[model samples]
Target: MELISSDKRNQLFERFAHDAFHLELRDDYSVPNEVGPFEDWLNGRESDDSFMAPWLQLMKRVTESGKTVRRVRVVTEPHSPYIQWEHATTNVNEEAGELIRWLPRHKLPAGLHFPVDGNDWWLFDDKLLAVGHFDDGGRVLGSEIIDAPEIVAECIRVRDLLWSIATPTNEYQL
Candidate 1:
């Protein structure tokens, strides 16, 4: 299957109406742009978050127009270092109008099965899906765009189920 580059997938942000939701199941993401920031955070040094500027700007625009961006992060606790950093920084995303929630992996309902081969995905308006593909080193490859009715429907169901139980970022404690 053909996969679109992350840049291309992000363009969906410009087109999607209503809501865009992301499911993050990984404890670490080795995004190249994040390498410096992550390392700085790990070393207890001040870190610059300018790398997130573009995405934050986009989310700000999207939410300002009445569209919503949300994410459910299924994490394993005690949180990984990266997750801890993410938890600390999530307020920035929220400030840009993205609603984020966290759910411990152990808290997922029994028998719940993730769709799209258990890969992370972004669902737009409950109609389109951009399923993330990653290399073995935890780096992103790209995303496969899937709009098949059955697949999108399954993702929507999962999004709803997880969203219902996940704790809003503000209420979650380390």
Candidate 2:
């Protein structure tokens, strides 16, 4: 299957109407842009979050236009360092208009199964999906675009189920 570059995948955000939802299933993410910030946090230094400016801006623009952007992060009970950092910074995301929730992996509904081979995905308007792909080391390798009705349907089902049970970031404790 062909995968589109992250830039191309982000372009979908512009075309999608109504809403966009992201399902995050990883304990840690090794995004290159986040390397420095993550390290700084680990070392007890003040980490700069300028890297997120663009994404924050995009989210602001989208939500201001009446579109909703949301995400459900399913994580292990003992959060990874990256996840801890993500949690601390989530308020900025919310301030920018994104709705983020956290779900402890153990709390997931019984018998819940992930679609698209258990990969992370972004569902746009309940119609399109940009499924994230990663390299051996967990760095992102772009995303595969899938719009098949059956697949999109399954993702939508999972999204609704997970969203219902996940705790909103503000209320979720470390």
List residue ranges in candidate 2 displaced over 4 A. none
Model 1 misplacement above 4 A:
none
The residue pairs found clashing in candidate 1 are none
* Root-mean-square deviation of every model: 0.7, 0.7
Q: How many residue pairs clash in all the candidates, one count each?
A: 0, 0
Per-residue accuracy of model 2 over 65-120 as CA lDDT, tens digit each: 99999999999988888899999989889999999999999998889899999999
CA-RMSD of model 1: 0.7
TM-scores for the candidates: 0.98, 0.98
